[model samples]
Target: MFGIGIPELIVILVIALLIFGPNKLPEIAKSIGKAFADFKKAADDVKSSIEHEITKIEEEGKKTEVDATAPAKGAVEDKEIKK
Candidate 1:
């Protein structure tokens, strides 16, 4: 997948077979697959946590903005009533 074509893959697999032997190859592949899966899961969890924090911060900001303007609006209404 990383730019290695079929021939390259075959050569690499042959080398692995020579070095690691067929008995250990499947176990290694399984371990590698599990590691990648765990990594992906951790990344997704962090992404979701960050998104939740951002959403909470945005909501708090909107609430603060509305609260800040409310007092001014009330002051304006009071002046209009006096006039």
Candidate 2:
């Protein structure tokens, strides 16, 4: 997948078969698959957590913006009522 063409892949597979034998191939494949799956799962979790924190920070920023305007709005209303 990493830019290795079919010919390259075939050669690598042949080498592996010779080194490890057919009997151990399936076992090795399974372990490699599991490791990649776990790594992907962990990466997704970290990405989601960072997104959640950013959303929380944005919501808090919105709340602060509204709060900041409230005092000025109240002051204007009070002045109009007095007039």
The candidate that wins on TM-score is: 2
Candidate 1: lDDT over CA atoms? 0.93
lDDT scores for all predictions? 0.93, 0.93
List residue ranges in candidate 2 displaced over 4 A: 72-83
Model 1: lDDT of residue 12: 93
lDDT of 1 by residue, 22-55 (tens): 9999999999999999999999999999999999
- State, as a TM-score between 0 and 1, how close model 1 is to the true structure: 0.81
Summed backbone clashes in each candidate are 0, 0
Q: Please give, for residues 17-63, the per-residue lDDT of candidate 2 as tens digits.
A: 99999999999999999999999999999999999999999999999
User: Candidate 1: minimum summed lDDT over ten consecutive residues — where?
Assistant: 71-80
